[model samples]
Target: MLVWLSLVLCYLAFLALALAMPRHHEQLRGRKPGRGLVWLLRITGAVLLGLSAWPALIWWGNPAVAVSSWLGILSVAAFAVAMMLTYASGWWRTTLAGAGTAAILLLVLPVFLHP
Candidate 1:
């Protein structure tokens, strides 16, 4: 589940970054998002990039596999994001918004719900 969820978040970040570009910007969010949304994309992209490090550091136990893991996650994330954005632009925005919310919740969940 974490894998799938992570994929969604990573892909969301990718899509956000793409939408930041003017050519594709209007295709996303039903309008050209203002500076705030662009900043959100950049910040969330950084956050998700950092989040990718989480699984890498945990599963690999150090700098050994971190790069590979991060790259692998990034590659898969980009591919999935491109496909979705190309074939399902209508659903992409809403799904990304929802998944982005879920991703942030998951990230902060332990802080609030931990024992």
Candidate 2:
């Protein structure tokens, strides 16, 4: 469906953003990024963003699905905000935590609200 496709695209964009963050940070600092950290950042960011956006596919169905879709959107937005903060300040941990929390909430909230 279109929702699923959009979710995929959003996640891929997040992945690219994640991969680029470290390089951006390094450039800001006039140095090279640590390779291990860059890989970790890219993988973690992609997983978190992908999971957060995954639920948006629920929008295609019932009220339960709608709720799930909304939650996904919320999580993705939160992750984006967190990423923006990291990009601006070069603080990675806090933003990563924010993204993780948002993703977890997206996975948990739907079950409680719908059932």
Candidate 3:
């Protein structure tokens, strides 16, 4: 579903943005991230967050509802990411991998699965 995809992408975007910071990266990886890596994470996070809006536009086909839905999805995703960082920091790596795989699968599967 577009809603689910948007939520996952938003969550991933927030995770990437969080990990771009030195403290969070160090917390999760046990080492500071390089400048290049930080920049990459930042750009990737921004782009993914932007991409998450596409499904809403396609599904809703109305600017107002689409914008509101995207905002709601972002809020839920941000809260989920904050909770993960606060309470489940140890699982960051696993969560990142799983979310990345899920995002890819969601993007690809619909192409083949659509009637």
Question: Against the hidden true structure, what lDDT does model 1 obtain?
Answer: 0.72
lDDT of 3 at 6: 92
Ranking by lDDT: 3, 1, 2
lDDT of 2: 0.55
Overall lDDT per candidate, in order of appearance: 0.72, 0.55, 0.93
Give candidate 1's root-mean-square deviation (CA, Å): 3.2
TM-score of each: 0.72, 0.44, 0.94
- How many clashing pairs per prediction, in order? 0, 0, 0
Candidate 3 local lDDT, 2-98, one digit each (tens): 8888988999999999999999999888999999999999999999999999988988999999999899999999998899999999988888889
lDDT (C-alpha) at residue 23 in model 2: 64
State residue 115's C-alpha deviation in candidate 2, in Å.
3.0
The count of residue-pair clashes in candidate 3 stands at: 0
Write one digit per residue (lDDT tens) for candidate 2, span 1-115. Answer: 4354434444444644544576655644556667786777677666655554444544455667765675676567547645664665464545445544554565566678885
Tens digit of per-residue lDDT, candidate 1, span 1-115: 3444556667777876887766678876667778987888788777876776665566566676666766777899898778877898778757777877877776777578768
**lDDT of model 2 at residue 58?**
46
Superposed model 1: Cα runs more than 4 Å off: 1-5, 101-115
